[model samples]
Target: MSTTTEARSGFSPRVALQKVGTSLSNMVMPNIPALIAWGIITAFFIEDGFTPVPALGGFEDAAGNPHLGIVDPTIHYLLPLLIANTGGRMIYEARGAVVGVVATMGVIAGSDELVTMLNLTQPSDEQIGQIHMFIGAMIMAPLAAWLMKKLDQLWQERIPAGFEMLVNLFSAGIFSFLMALIGFYGLAPIVNGLMNLLGAGVEGLISLGLLPLVSLLIEPAKVFFLNNAINHGVLTPLGLTEASQNGKSVLFLLEANPGPGFGILLAYSFFGRGAARASAPGAALIQFVGGIHEIYFPYVLMKPALILAAVGGGMTGVFLNVLFDTGLRAPAAPGSIIAIFGNATTDSYLGIALAVIGATVVSFLIAALLLRIGKQEEGDIAAATAKMEEMKGKKSSVAGALTGAGAGAAGAASAADDSGHTGRIEKIVFACDAGMGSSAMGATVLRKKVRAAGFDDVEVTNKAISSLSDEWDVVVTQKELTDRARQRTGSAVQVSVDQFMNSPRYDEVVELVQQRNDPEAAEEGTGSEAAASTAAGAGVGVGTGAGAEPSADEGPGSATAPEILSPESIVLAGSATDSASGIDEAGALLVAAGAVDEGYVEAMHDREATVSTFMGNGLAIPHGTNEAKSSITRSAMSFVRYPEDIDWNGNPTRFVIGIAGVGDEHLELLQKVAMAFSDPAQVERLEQATTTDEIRAILGDEKESDA
Candidate 1:
């Protein structure tokens, strides 16, 4: 099966449905509070007799011609639109409130033009109100967005964990105060000035005429990125106003635009000869009738320069609307030929036809130019495609292995016998720097070799080297982790696999395992048993009946052994050490080990000048991960001491600087290092050690301590 099909198959239908439901809910949910606020306002207007249409449905007498009623019709028609526009803007433009709020206000004013056309309210007064609302909205949206972000950050950090719900409730209260501030102090003057300015034609030109100019000036490559920002940042918020004005929620505009289907069609069009020729026909059908503008997005994205052309076309269309003094009463819904009829003037058809023709021409010309200038190489495309496919395959294989392992574990548990014993072998864990790539492959090969040699009692697993310890019966790893693994597992056998550095020999490994498990079977009816016994009688320790010196080079006393230290001794020792020098020394050691870069030591020293690195206890793990220019492979430890007192975490530190070289793979080591420090006996010995050699001896000790 193709990779795409496999990826799709991995996601359950229920999960896909849940994602859809969540997206829909998020888009619509913000309007609920706005609806409640508007409802209260509407009810107040009705009771005050300011409403033109009564709540219970009755027009007041013309003789009484209530002033309240005159204002009521305008309020009733415009308030809902204002709330929706504001709320919708908030939802879509999550990060930038200023743009969203202004766009929403614009949407409300734009949509209110529809009410004027319908004769629900007088045009002059409504137009003035529209201008006021637009200006007010523009100012408030950004302020609200900023306030929301600040409150969110404050709640996440300062509030206690369990009081999250209370914090959310408090945020709402704060938002209400902000809203009130805007209504009383912020909105009034801005609205009044905007109404006055909008009276002149300059406002129209500034708002609409500049669009085409801006589009032309922007670099073609950057236009689509800007377009995405504008749609989410500006247009979505505008939809809110439409929803609020008509008492019809238009939140779906945020989701429906620039449809995914169009993108798919455009991508296929690049390879499909027939599809490219029919592109305009398909776009016209979907965009004009179905009102799906996204049907063209794929085409635009395929050649990004076309996006600039589209922007140019859009700006031109907006400018023409201004020139013709045209206004949309409602947001042009189902954005197509038929929908335009609802809002179109005598010049509307001509405006739209010009927009489509101009946009198409720009897009086509730019695409053709780009294609002609730089045709893609077939070899490069094929290579990239192959690499992508390989990565996809590896991911699939790993996922399948994990799934199979989980299922096997479950089955084993369920199939236990009456003796409460399942026929499952114990897991043998092998670890290194990064878990489960090379190590995992090695484990698989080792497991096969072991099983073939009839050692089926164990099942092999691989993990990060840092996790190797008492977790497994026998820990297997490369030479680098030999010292660390031995420190963690005192008596537990550790097999350092040289096969990692060299090519693996499966047959030799199988034979070795067999020999280790059954010495008597191999020695049967042979004089070699006598020779082995003779060797054993000698002062030599044999591994697999092979005569070899246990201490090959050094004397028995020279073997590194573990040391136990008391917590009090550790503290006292640390008190005598110079803390600053200790940290510097530790940094220097790491640099020498090639685990960290040189300047890193200096940076750490500089950081230390400002604050102490001693987190707590007698432990001072001083290190720098960011100093290295390239990726780190393993962590390195450096032991240091001061002859005199040094201030640690408010305590005098004598023994200091436990450097940990942390890389992507070495995180596990940090945990083990932490465990080592936790032991009071180890801490005492670490502090008491006078020389670097003494410290290394104590650390290298494999024996268990009673402290």
Candidate 2:
């Protein structure tokens, strides 16, 4: 892995803030249903509701007696507690949740105390309203839980054996009580003041006609996977606070409005070129009707200038909402038209409707004009899907299906030719989140396969997804990050894999590269590279059973540094029952051979605890961590084969190769081993080998023959 690649420098302010926002949203997103239920109840039964119910709405009854209602208590206690409990659980699970609720009660109590104090000091008409502690809960819950976790860790094993239950119970009770007092006296007042200031700021923004400018910040963040963060983290609590006090809030529409995404997709449908134009209509329906605004993020990213359309559309909606004083009684999730209507204030219907319409029109017109001015053609739907995945950093089945991204490795073969080049894949880049660890390992494995396939002209390197460029002929990524890789380049064929150590996809990529090379071979007609036969259907998954015909490339002497592996070190059908015992057996072999100290075996276990050594295709390469490198006496490897699988960190493992590498010395034999096992056929031959001699033959170096 190249460290110079565009790896995120330490602590990016943007990424850090986004992560914090994401964490806040995580606490609320799972509880959206409860918020929706509250919204429905308020819309239907509150004092100004269509059918007011004093009993449920907490209003004066027909007899002029006030009744406590579900509305007041739900917002005052239930919602805050729910938020607290969710926040706590995120920090420390059930124990954290308990402490969080305990602390939140104090905040709620302090809020009531403040309300009572205001009533005593001020005239009834000027008295302060009940301050709900939603913000306080958001703060105190996670804080209380984190403190409890650290406290418990302090005495984790110091407690006497029989007093464990008593110590735990009393400690938690005392800690909760202390935290509750802190919440009531310290955090609650601070949060209350903060909320008041924020509420006033929003009112000021609205009055000054500058509230619409928020769309500039919001619209761009949505494309970067921060939609939930902005919606649930910043807006929801404030919107809920306003709704609790005034029965409706415009804040909900700021991010939830679907008009902007819908308009962008609609514009693409009419003015965009290639697959973006073809797929825009369906994406428009998903965005507008399905309330999945994320579908249109790719369209904006494909042509970054299109974000102006989103900003304009967002501003138009907010401007209309401000002008008409239109607002929803509850947050409109999915930003769907139906949801928006369902949650609108009774008198705000026309205004809300117009806001949506105006937003859509503005966005569409802006996007259409930009498309016309730029005239940039999106390569194809596959490229669009790749771009979508690249930005999202995850494989989206919906994106693939929506953009026809399912073309897989086979479709990548035409990528070179499609771009008006002779079909040749010269540069391959392996990408992961940080472009380290597993990605580098996967690249090494694939690079070995590519070289063995006789495509030595191909360049293989590992890169952080952030550094991916269009210069590469092919880009490979782990399954989780494949979607993110797609957005990096339009010309590269994209490949995804679950197992970096041995993926069938590696063979498929090698085959694609070889196919691209075949055209050049045919043009030459008499080159030895063309004359040399390749194993037929070598890329196909085949078992290399005993007596199976060898691939032309796997001839004897192809192995590099053959002395590193010997028949004496090979063990078949080992007696180990599980991964630990299996590690012990493999490590013992290396110990006896003087390859490593006994401490190295323990280090291997530690390394395994950090990350599983399991490399796909039934192989686990157990090695000591960097800290344990001093235990190595020489660069050597020992192989142990288990006929029956041992579970190696949830992956079924049949082979364990204990390695003690002195810098890059071990990479040579490691590469040869990768080449042998990369072919399922060769792996099958090793599995079926009855004698140690046969095992040695299969495991021997098979680097490309120099002669």
Specify the highest-TM-score model's number.
2
The residue ranges of model 1 lying beyond 4 angstroms of the native Cα positions read 1-127, 130-175, 187-225, 228-275, 278-284, 294-327, 342-707
Cα RMSDs, all models: 23.4, 13.3
lDDT, candidate 2, 347-458, per-residue tens: 8899988998999999999998998888686646555555554444333435644555443332343332232222346688887654433455567666655665566667
* Alpha-carbon runs more than 4 Å astray in model 2: 1-10, 61-66, 379-398, 406-707
What is residue 203's positional error in candidate 1, in angstroms?
4.8
The TM-score of predicted model 1 comes to 0.32
342-444 in candidate 1: lDDT tens per residue? 4333334464445444444444444445444644322222222223212212111111121122211111111111111111224556565545223543454
- lDDT for 441 in candidate 2 is 59
Q: Give the Å shift of residue 500 in candidate 2.
A: 14
When summed lDDT is taken over every stretch of 10 residues in candidate 1, the lowest stretch is: 414-423
